[model samples]
Target chain A: MSIPADLKYTKSHEWVRLEADGSVSVGISHHAQELLGDMVFVENPTVGRKLVAGEECAVVESVKAASDVYSPIAGEVVAANGDLEGAPETLNQDSYAAWMFKLKPANAADLDGLMDATAYAAHVASEAH
Target chain B: MLKQTPLNAKHHEANAKLVDFSGWEMPIHYGSQVEEHHFVRNDAGMFDVSHMLPVDIKGEGARAFLRKLVANNIDKLQTTGRALYTCMLHEGGGVVDDLIIYFMSESWFRLVVNAGCADKDLAWMEVQRDKLAPKLSITPRRDLAMIAIQGPNAAAKLWAAMPGTRELAEAMKPFHAVVVGEMFVARTGYTGEDGFEVMVPNKAAPFFWQALLEAGVKPCGLGARDTLRLEAGMNLYGQDMDEGVTPFDSGLAWTVDMSGERDFIGKDALSRLPRNRQLVGLKLLDRGVLRGHQSVFTAQGEGEITSGSFSPTLNGSIALARVPVGIKVGDTVEVDIRGKRMKAAVVKYPFVRNGKALV
Candidate 1:
């Protein structure tokens, strides 16, 4: 239930962090990884690939089921976390630390359109029922 | 509201993630499904299988009625307490449901059917009972609750959990049930491990579950159960086959009894119809996990995967598929997994047995 106020989130459960280099790192949220429970495989979008907002650019498969990781905003994938290829369960250990991929935003202003910690927390609550 | 088992509270207390399975609110996993699967293979684990119903058939013509109702011959049970794994078929050769019949006496017998098909099975049994043996009593034992404790050390843990009942079950053989007071303990399990499927009254389930937990038996959910059963090469009732397919093509032909003159339901259809499909196991050589409903490509023709999962015991993906009859073991098949055709090898099933890999 740790929603770091520093990062932003999408309704589909991907969290985005604006790094010091102006690039954004994206990964599934703690809630998403918790629901998935025990990751078995992680497939990141190809590096240097263009992505549209809300596009399914990655995948996170757990022992229970597979889930699509949607891109929060339009961007070009700069780096895919090759580390996850060997250890996908690192997300279960620490989701925020295990970023799936990083992107160079198409429009940095689009970050404002995404939900903050409070809004995303409410979005997660709305789904419980 | 979905149905809840007597041990539902226990599952919640153990911090289980609950899911709606076949109209019943059951636990899919306690915490980690893969970890639970391994624990059951290495040690002892227990499952609350109360959703599955038991039917007690009692009367002078009980055995005679069952002989006509199911596909496999019940005449093979020469002694009391023996259990036979078989399928109940419709008027045609299609499987109505797969069940285990336990012979308690000449006039008394018990059957355990899948949870999802309990109502339909009960209705079918009643219809057949009225026509064949009006003097028979077909009773659904919903009052009883069942729990399966399994693993290599399952017996020792069970003996430690409940005292005094050990001596009654100590000398029991596999596929046999010994009733002690109100508890019916069977030396059979869905997992390939050695253990007992103990059935007791609903009120006593909580106590037994607690005792077993205190004895260090880890609580497992359906998630682990599915993987374990898949590894053991056991067929699920709905996912594997239904009223549209018979046991002949569902890897259950050995369970069908055309060996004797015993006339049963769907016997003529089984004899007359041509079985051009066969169920075989698949070992994935690709990266992704194999799952159900995926299309399979074979040298003979097209096929479909019935059940598939990542086998925790083998640390690889395996599946059961229904393919054209010509497919043989060691043959290669490609499975369409998320639109990607991955190479998989066709092999004999029961991929893992007795806590060891066979494929």
Candidate 2:
């Protein structure tokens, strides 16, 4: 429900925060964590791994089920959240702060293609019905 | 639309995260399922298990009818208010459902059966009653609501919430039930903890649930119920044993009551069929979690994990697998976790009991 206006989102529930630098920090949305319940394990994409847009780059598994974390846009993974391996529940606690990985965008313009806060909120609302 | 329990609106009011469970809209959790699981393990917790069905059998021939209906020897239930856990099976020896039968009197018995299979179970019981005991009356008590209060301190906490229940239930042993007016309290639960499953009239359920919450018993959901049951090595109805699997292969042979003189519905088929598989517990030596339907490789042959999960108590994965009868305790088996063949040790279940790790 807390879709920050400064952030962008994908239909699959990944959120992206564009940094001052060229890199963008990406994590799952608050809605995503709520749906998945308590996360037990998070497998993030390795640094330097090149991913195409919408590629399944990582997996976040809860006690109930596992879900693939898809890449919002084509990019090279610059950093992986190693802290998650020890405590995956961090994503459940503060998903916006506990970014899964950093990506150097392959096409920076792809960021505009993702849903902004207003559009993403509408998308989430539509899903309820 | 999914089926709703009598307490469904109450769960929604408490902000429960609801999910579709076998066509019923049930609460998976309120917030954190792990916290709920830990709460029940450490303190008291309550679950609105009204989705489970309670059927009442009344008549002069009630005892005789149940004697031939279920696999367990209900004749053992001589004392009033005594409860027995038993399996109902098909003619092919496949499991129909597992249920708890409470003997209130010679003419009246109460059966609590799983929610998903209630309709099928009721029809089956009706057919059997017609053929075996035409005088018996079969009544489905959907008008009742069930709540399970479970944990080490559950009984005392429930007593605190509903005064006078402790004195009434204190003398009752495990698998016993006592009726206090409209409230029927039973000293039984699926969780491996000292607890009570209370059945109250449908209209009074919400008030009782609120009282329990005010008494500081955490409201747990089905997600925690599953993990706790798995850790306790209890067999889930559809997952562990279904119409495809027999009670003999599901580690429930003791409940079959084959030695009893009374002839049950599935006795002849069970006696004639040879059991080639046996259910056993597996403790994973590897790092991954074990889950249902995972293939298991043993020296004898291949088997399947019927119920598996990460044990919050053991801090590792454990499973109940149906393996070849040749396998023994302490034998090593390989489970296909992802693409890796993980080594696991076979042992007798339950992996934990009464807040202590047994294996």
Top-scoring candidate (TM-score): 1
Candidate 2 regions with alpha-carbon error over 4 angstroms: none
User: Compared with the true structure, what per-residue lDDT tens digits does model 2 show for residues B93-182?
Assistant: 888999999999998999999999999999999888889998899999989999999998898788889986877898889899999878
Clash pairs of candidate 1? none
Per-residue lDDT of B7 in model 2: 90
Q: All models: lDDT?
A: 0.92, 0.90
Which residue segments of model 1 deviate by more than 4 Å?
none
Query: Residues A10-63, candidate 1, lDDT per residue (tens digit)?
Result: 999999999999899999899999898878878888989999999998888887
By summed lDDT, the worst window of 10 consecutive residues in model 1 chain B runs over B308-317
How do the residues B190-219 of candidate 1 rate in per-residue lDDT, one tens digit apiece?
999898999999999999999999999999
